[model samples]
Target: MNSLNSPWAAHFIQTGAGNNQSFEQAGALTLENIKTLFAECDKPYSGLPPSALKKAIYSSDLSQVQPLEKVIEQTNRLIAKNSIMVQHPHCIAHLHTPPLISSVMAEFYIAALNQSMDSWDQASSATFLEQFIVDWLVQTFSLGADADGVFTSGGTQSNLMGLLLARDWFANTHSQHNIQQDGLPEYGHKMRIICSDKSHFTVQKSASLMGLGERAVVCVKTNQQGQMDIDELQQTIEALTAQDLLPIAVVATAGTTDHGAIDDLHGIVTLCRQYGLWSHIDGAYGGALMLSEKHKYRLKGIESADSVSVDFHKLFYQTISCGALLVKDKSNFSSLLYHADYLNREGDELPNLVDKSIATTKRFDALKMFMTLKSVGAQTLGEMYDKLIELSAQVADSVKENDHFELCCEPLLSTVLFRLSSHYQGSLSSGEFNQLHQTLRLQLLTSGDAVIAETKVNGKLYLKFTLLNPCLTLSDFDSLFAKIESHAKLLTNKAL
Candidate 1:
């Protein structure tokens, strides 16, 4: 068999799979490729239907597939044909952003090496590297003395780890037995978790997975800006106590997903301490802001948390599928530890990561993060954080200055919510107002000139922009708003 004729071999040769490109050269290549793909970058949409797009991708018949060179051409065409460009400055939806270019190159190395940090024997050097990065993150956050953690897929997994640990800790302390072996029989069903209404939905999902019912997550109210109200939190805890429910943990969010609002961390920490509740800070979205000394103050008292969740992909400039759950005590892994003779033959073996994580085979995600921080230095990353926050403020200013849009909330971190201004403020029926907001969002998506986000607030439609790209400037917002306004006017015309 001619190896050159093998599709896999042909693909590798065609794409230079085994060849490494220097950072400078790769970056230039990426830029050139991007320019070539998006020839008319200013176009509003790709103008391709879902069926047509699927047909194009599925056109590749492996049984009679063309040479790998043709596949590369198709791949480039796919990139050029999509409107979902997170790297573009005008993409202002959700927490999406352009990851650092250097980290992207590091990701290539990680993928090629394919290090699985499941156990020491399988990934000795990779395991140690991951451990070192985790230790550094623990120290950086000042989690606690002898704190430990592991990299995860993302915020949802990290959040789940925190909840799982909290559940095990509560179980072990109350039951005087191992929950992993004995289950939650000793602790009973009185255990519950608590978070603010603005907290990520993952908290509730995590609770349900931890054997606590979805209703077990008590929702504390928040202030006007979406910051969790300390008074309401305390009252909720007290009410739960009166009902004889054990409050297992308090989950404080450093940045709520909707508006990037930082909770009253100092106050929340104090209350957690007073109540003897395990405190977990869901800083997955905002934890990277700790890199910036100027804005680190917003996360004051976060150091008091028993555990913290941080997503490197969110702002650490790492690619997607990178997050961490840091614990104050190294021994917290005891609850999750599992042993088997076949896999645990080495007496001096370092702990298997599967014992610590929810998954068995985990990617070497720490490589990208470690390389990114080392290559760019913490100072540069911090500066990038500051720049994005400042850029978000600039976006808000643009919104306020324009007669077409209004600022819905003060950006507590790097998110801005606003909506098109309308004189039809005369209380339209709720149904009518919601209908308008829905129409506005659909209009923007179909336009595709500028990507935006929408979320419901107190039954009102609100457009949102999550600015996490340092490369974007206020001028980007000018175009973003101009497109939004143009589309919104069309909606208004249809309504009339």
Candidate 2:
């Protein structure tokens, strides 16, 4: 049989060959299907219960081959329809951001090209483009002339890279021990990483993954504003020294998860320098502020960090799974460097990105940022983030003025933490109060009215509004607050 007559011929994307019309048809059909899906859903979520959603998705038959249209129709019915709408004004539950249109377009090209960033031969242009993006990021953050970076999956991977390098660098410098060639050194058990109590959980997770237990992370108490307490950090370091334990690195958070608090980077770096420790800044959320002329001062000392993690998916409004880990000295990447003779051959003049990355077959995610930067310049993106920050402050002020709500703290970035007031709580017990907040958040979500975040602060439950959408206005939030009030009343009446 002629290969062109086979059933599989039309399914694969082909270029510069016979009968390429299927590619165009498939692209059009898929895009139209997506547009229809978006237009059909009015709410941020379908409000489907978990079991029902699961069963509906699982019912699809993957055993049989289906036409593109049939598969897309099923996806619309079972999957896309029920997914959370991050672009919705009420959908401000997490660090998730609605991707920029430019980045979305770049995603299409990224997937279509299917370039393996590991080797120059597989992705000649892509490899160089990623290097350019990494170089630009290093320069933009003022990571010094000797600094370099590599894109990763997201914050978790980036944070791991930072901690991994810190551990290896410390081992090599202190005892002339090579962690890559050999296992962990004898003092590895005593090595410690210090961060604020409000730091992202990845810091502890990274330590455990690096063979150091969670106990290796000594969390200094945060201040009232949720910033890392500089004095407490110094005290903790001195105490660790007194105990003869080795403190390898200090992980400072630029924007905490719940409170959006940025630690005192300058103070933390100063302490790190005094104590002769490596400094890493986890700027996965607030790192975008470097582009903001108005708020860049918040991350003043980030440039001096021994390593830094920046996620483009958060405040930068890029697509998900886009992040970079930067190091002050390019030599730090030696910890993860390797020469795969078949891929990144030694003495090859061409650059192979996998040497600086933990991932080998990485997507061309750098193109998304590159396209976004080119289409909408950094200043515009910074202004969009600035608008969100301004909106968060407005929401905080409004919450303070409301009689039914209790404001937690002044938002340093775009997250507003608050809870129902005692007046609204009435005679409910401590447990009841916590349950009420939790129930209120769920009721709103399950009803598809809003998607607010719920978190615990000092053992007390609180509602969070991670205001990531710059297009949202005070009126939109006012409407959402009215819905929240109504939901709380309904839940409270039921409990009573």
Candidate 3:
């Protein structure tokens, strides 16, 4: 039977007719359910153990169909109730950011429209909107008139695209061979990509996926400040050449995960030019600094990079999974070009976004950034980021002053790495000291007092505070510290 005559007629969104009442009702209901759920949960998390949560989630019978209102209620009870509340002031664990209200509103429009970005016919206006945003990004980074970019899932996918283009470009320029058409060359095993030891793990992961194995990634050690040691980097590159290795590219990190150290971009780019290697700047975290007039100097020479990766979800306050990869030379994207008769025909004059991306059937993610830029404006976003950096510095100083905590180093962006003082450890062995920190973190999480992160630095445990929330103030952190101290004292007393 036709949908109009069937029982499901009310479920579909009807265009050209009056407003879809069902959609309006469902949207209002969902929003109310979410507000109620947030009001009931006071902590960043519900503090439910994995086993209990799993049992509660599976208790519902999925085979049974229910009305939209009932479905929303069940979802809140089972899923949203247990999910991490990233917007909470004390949820300072990862790079995740609380999405901006403007971007959140954009997400609703994005979902309702359901535009697929691969072809123009499926996303006519969306395709052009994405291009306009990309053009603006290219200009913001000073990537030249010939540059272009495409939105990606996040840093991982963007990094992969940079390396893929670098590999193909190197192969074609040097040996007149096309790696995409011919696969890895005979000397593929000798090809090497270089990055600092503090670079994201995605560098090695990309190398493995490219069929060069993990060994193809040559890591240069960092300096005392956690930045890539420029002198050591030069030595490493020279050593690789002496060993007859083919160094095709250098991935310079704009921000390290643990220390938030920004590498010397100009220094790295200079060396890359000297060696005739492709220079890629992985600015997934610190790229937002370009908006800050005060901190933009840290990203000097970024414009000279052959490619760059930026994530809006991190510091830009957009929703999750929104990032872009920009290339200095737009023609380099030819390596990823492919045609399909049904979707992106070769002779078609209309712009198809699939030609610039590794993904097809992509969501209209660019709309989120477009709306955010228009509503919030770039100047306000810059000031917000600057405030986060200032807060990190203040926290670091406070940690140094407290006898109970030991500051690892100064924060360059917004991450502070520190640990409990040795006096608090009471002559415990190295392993036990690390265990103490781990236990305290867990205790805080279980009590739902705070949600902090832990990482190892130089084989010693260090707690990390990734300050991404601009709304948070020093007073908020003071309270969080008091809870941490209480937890630590309880654990230490138990050990005694």
Candidate 4:
């Protein structure tokens, strides 16, 4: 049982548990198997009911290992049947996008080697590559030579990092205590963050995570265009100051979630500077506009921000969980630094990425962008995004022209907010219309004919077309709108 002489025995042990450096295999078998599995995923969705889908996945037992071929087949079935195919042209929901093929190809190597960005010793070249990518991002934001950044899982983590640093900076400069050493300062409840009402909910959620209660978040009013009203923000700040509350930071949205609204960055930044408050821009959805010469101006004050969150997965056409947090001054990252003797000792000169990120064992996702940039330069990506931004305006006009649909506002970015108007006068109330939109959205989702987004604005439910698919045309949206009308009409008839 313990014989080491046999080549087969050695191979089995090496492949199962030994480090790749000590015992590496070609991995050809698994790669070929996965390729075959991917070939089966042709449909946008599985079309299976919730219960049936659960049964398919949960029925498999983990007590014993199955044949590799059978496992591959099962995985193929899952990929083909159960996945939410973001690549589908009709999947204009959320900030999701069809990933660039080059980025997907880069994931193969990223997964194979399994590099971590936490320590320079572990990731080696990956660490430098990530830093290079971060530098490119800093340059893109025009944050100057002093700018620096770190990649994150996504917007949430980046937002958290931004708030965390801001929190620590507040504790250090405003008070005698250091939060990193002595915990949250006294009167922490008095600390507050200000942002537009349309900014992502992550701002409030992040405050809660940092021990600042949700009440610490102050929602400033936005204009009809969904941008943060600068006048209202100034008044709110003055009122907060009169109350003697600590204004820690002001979070600005480069693009609001529902309306794709871009707040006046210059306006917000001016106020932040005036108040001596940290400026953080949540550009998770609209950050990619920086690539476009035409649209980059939308994110004007983003370069002036102390911290910025950009999700490449959203507009860059990259896979999930690829985002970055950039800082105008590289030294501000010291708030996140806590040298680990065993990992990145004080004596070590090499860069330790963990000092700047919430995650330690991070994937080399920057490779996806690097590969994409190398294959088809940044200008091409910008052009693709410009195409969509232009399309969103056209789609909004289509909705306005259609008597059946009530357009929420002029299209700002790639999102068009609208709702189906009920013809029944006095019979259907605002609440009933809300229910109608909710019902229609669910109906369409269940049918899998199309996947769109929905959000409530001014207490009125509205449908959203978060169009990120560059290849999709106004005709595709027209077809989807037609289906919505047909579906809504059928529902209305049944009710009558």
- Best candidate, lDDT-wise? 3
Which is the better candidate, 3 or 4, if ranked by lDDT?
3
Q: lDDT tens digits, residues 1-496, model 1? A: 9565565542242344443233335446655666786565664346465577778778766787664345555666774656576776767777866778777787877776777778778888888888889988988888776789988998899889888888888777765667789777644578889999999999999988888878889998888788888998999889999998899899999889998988988898889889878888999889887899899988998887888899988888778878898998878877877776655555754757777877888898888888887789888889988998888887788888988777888798899988767653335566676677677766566556666788877767788888888877777777777777777677666666
Model 4, span 1-496: residue lDDT tens: 5454454453343334443332333355556655664566543555676677788778888897875556656675664457777766677778888889998889888986789889998899999999999989998889999999999989999998998888888788887678878889887889999988998889989999999988999999888778998999999999999999988899999888888899989888989899989999999988899999998988888888999999989888888879999998888787777877878787789988999877878999999989999998899999998999899999988998998888889988889998886573136677876887788887777777667789988898889989898998888878888888888888887655
lDDT tens per residue, model 3, 254-369: 98888888999999999999998999999999999999988999999999999999999999999988999999999999999987898888788999999989999898999999
RMSD of each: 3.6, 1.3, 1.2, 3.3
Looking at model 2, residue 438 earns an lDDT score of 92
Clashing residue pairs, backbone N/CA/C < 3 A, model 1? none
Model 1 residue 112 distance off true place after TM-score fit, in angstroms: 1.0
Full-model lDDT, candidate 4: 0.84
CA lDDT for candidate 1: 0.79
Q: Estimate each model's TM-score.
A: 0.91, 0.98, 0.98, 0.92
C-alpha lDDT values of all predictions: 0.79, 0.90, 0.91, 0.84
Error of 3 at 27 (Å): 0.8
- Candidate rank order under lDDT: 3, 2, 4, 1
In candidate 4, how many Å is residue 433 off? Answer: 2.0
lDDT of 2 by residue, 274-373 (tens): 8889999999999999999999998999999999999999988889879999999999898788877798776889888888888988989999999999
